[model samples]
Target: MVGMEADGKMGVHLDVSTPGYAGRLEVVEGPTGRRVRSASEKARIAAESLMPGAQVSAIARKHGATRWQIYDWRLRLRLGELVLPESQEPLFAPLLVEEAPLPRVTPKPPKSAPAKVEIAINGMVIRTTVEVEQLAQVIRAVRASR
Candidate 1:
């Protein structure tokens, strides 16, 4: 007979008087299985699993979950389906801004003296550092004067 006992335990009573049946079968009630984790909890566990040198198996065992569950949660996090609470999220240190050092200014070498050339035209000598084109014009003017 399958029925609830007076002690609040559900049990099965077998007919021990029957041939070849000598033991009574009792069914004890236990806790309901399959815990439901919240999204924040999943996110927290997933984040912990992602930490440096963190072992997924250890984290999952600690949280009464499987490594696959943590992996799924991580996938959900990457897909934006899981959102970690602000307090549980990683924090970054504020950046410090400072003026960069001025670049070194090296002194330039002194400029070399311009080249000088002498030209003797119509027995009159000319020496200057003027450009070739300007010197040609001056020579032309001198020839035209004669």
Candidate 2:
């Protein structure tokens, strides 16, 4: 129950009856093996963890990062930010779009029967309609009449 500590330090040794001895349970801040992570550095590490066949869990653990951080980095890459070195074994390519040449669909002319033939009988004029395919037959029949 001593004076207030500005560092907001707290701890828990078997001693709560001590004054100003904030205890040993407080956060230990030092430069021993602790890494001072920069936002960009973390982002880069996280991004790498999401690469194809990468050991995300191992990378995260090594960097003292949560898997969710790596997952978040993947999402951000999708939205555009981080990028892998190469795409030889890529899961997917980034967004690609093309206008498709405005759909050069020159509408074709509607097809129609190439030709037609008509045969008449006397003045009564009974007409027998025939497809263009029979034109040769009609010519032969007329020639035989001569």
Candidate 3:
């Protein structure tokens, strides 16, 4: 036996050709009716269960499962591969759309006229009002700072 005490639940058998009873761990169909958890999911769940203070192995023992199985489920959960139990009817009255406050829309300021800055480069149309002397001073300051 690969597990502990035998639980009489009808589990999906991983070994199709082999017939036997499983105890703590059961090979069961997943939400998609697939035979097993995807390999990545298995690894992910294993990693989560291994996280500090996560009672993964104990949970497995209590649920008649393996730590690996819980870990696989955790991985699947992360990837959103597992399907939640569906209910067509809402258990409670859903809040009406109108009851919720509409999002506040911030009005954007109107665009202003573009500012002009002039450059000394040939063929360049500079719109800046800085005098030539000021430009020279700024350039010297910039170079000095650098």
Candidate 4:
């Protein structure tokens, strides 16, 4: 059997029975070997770290892992490298689809008619519709006479 103490040290208790021999108790130091965590176990641990008020240090200790390892697993899960187990399927809101209302089309008002201009050149009065082509000529004549 294997057991871990409060100080975070793991030790194994070995009992051997023989024809005429007494069992011996020996305490080994350090870890016997490296432990490989399965994918599902890693997912569970990573998810546990995300729970409300969950402490990374506590989780790491409970699972014999480091805080950085848990953080890395979370990053991998976000990047899609790790996926949740079958029992922990992802939940999502239903997608809603509806045709958007047609954009409003407002007809522009008719442009206002140009104003009728009256110009007095010296004592002579010139009354004519202000045409773009003749306005320049009228202005030139008035300036030359002045």
Candidate 5:
């Protein structure tokens, strides 16, 4: 604020407090800007976030990180880019399968009745219990005799 201009003019004054002027500009360093986190550190934070009932936002605040960062780390862990400590390998719940009861047996279909044929010709009635082909032959003979 005290330096003179290169051309020997009076020192310039910045009128920053004009109408509709916002507050002075400030550089807010976000999580990515403030520091660099190593893979191991990120893995640790991600593991902590996975604990029962652990909230990602709370974990991020505890480690001075953003929720997105923790989420990214979790994704990396899922993709195998990040590995958990040997003592903390993932655990799967035990499977307990029981034998299911046998399904109900459907009753066998009722036996079908044998086919019977009856023929009437010229006041004579013929009743026979035989296959369709035999019946047809008998009917042809009777017609020929007539």
Candidate 6:
């Protein structure tokens, strides 16, 4: 009989009266061999890992793979080493372009009157809108005349 022992180990127990009976049995633990996956299957799993909001660790666990394997597969896909089937190609909605509205035009305000400056030097008043440099020359000429 094959059964689990009290310590949680699996073992085979046989009756001593059985014919050709073995006195002992050997128990092996863990996986006896590595699992092999096909290229297409790996590609599919790799593509799924690239989906938005898809968790790499969860995808790896679901497909009996490690996170590193998923990442490697993604890299291979990017490098063109792995090709996705035609049906797996991404689809996009048609883009529609519409004409934008013209911007509104605003009327500019009326130009303000030019400011007038009056200078009084030696009781001789001079009123002009000339620039400061020209006014400085005039002031020098006026002072030199006095």
Model 4 C-alpha lDDT per residue in residues 49-115, reported as the tens digit of each score: 8877889999999999999999998888788777788887644346799999999989655555544
Best-matching candidate per TM-score: 1
Model 5 / residue 135 / CA error / Å: 51
- Predictions: Cα RMSD each: 13.6, 12.8, 19.0, 13.3, 10.7, 10.6
lDDT of 2 by residue, 62-96 (tens): 88877877788767767767654553344445888
TM, every model? 0.46, 0.33, 0.25, 0.39, 0.40, 0.42
Cα displacement (Å) at residue 110, model 5: 37
lDDT of 3 at 1: 42
Q: Residue-wise lDDT of candidate 1 within 1-146, one digit each (tens)?
A: 33322333455444345546546788878866789889988988888888778899999999999999999999998898998898754733467999999999986545556547777877888787855446567778777877
Model 2 residue pairs with clashes: 11-25, 12-25
RMSD of 3: 19.0
Which window of ten consecutive residues has the lowest lDDT sum in model 5?
1-10
lDDT comparing candidate 3 with the true structure:
0.56
Computed on alpha carbons, the lDDT of every model, listed in order, comes to 0.77, 0.64, 0.56, 0.74, 0.76, 0.74
Off by over 4 Å in 1: 1-26, 87-146
Q: What is the RMSD, in Å, between candidate 4 and the native fold over all Cα?
A: 13.3
> Model 6, 1-146: lDDT tens per residue?
33322333455434455556556889999886676877667788888988778899999999888999999998988888887777665523357999898888886555555446677877788887755446567768777877
Clashes of 2: 2
Least accurate 10 contiguous residues by lDDT in model 1: 1-10
Indicate whether candidate 2 or candidate 4 has the larger TM-score. 4
Give the C-alpha miss distance for residue 15 in model 3, angstroms: 33
RMSD in angstroms, candidate 1? 13.6
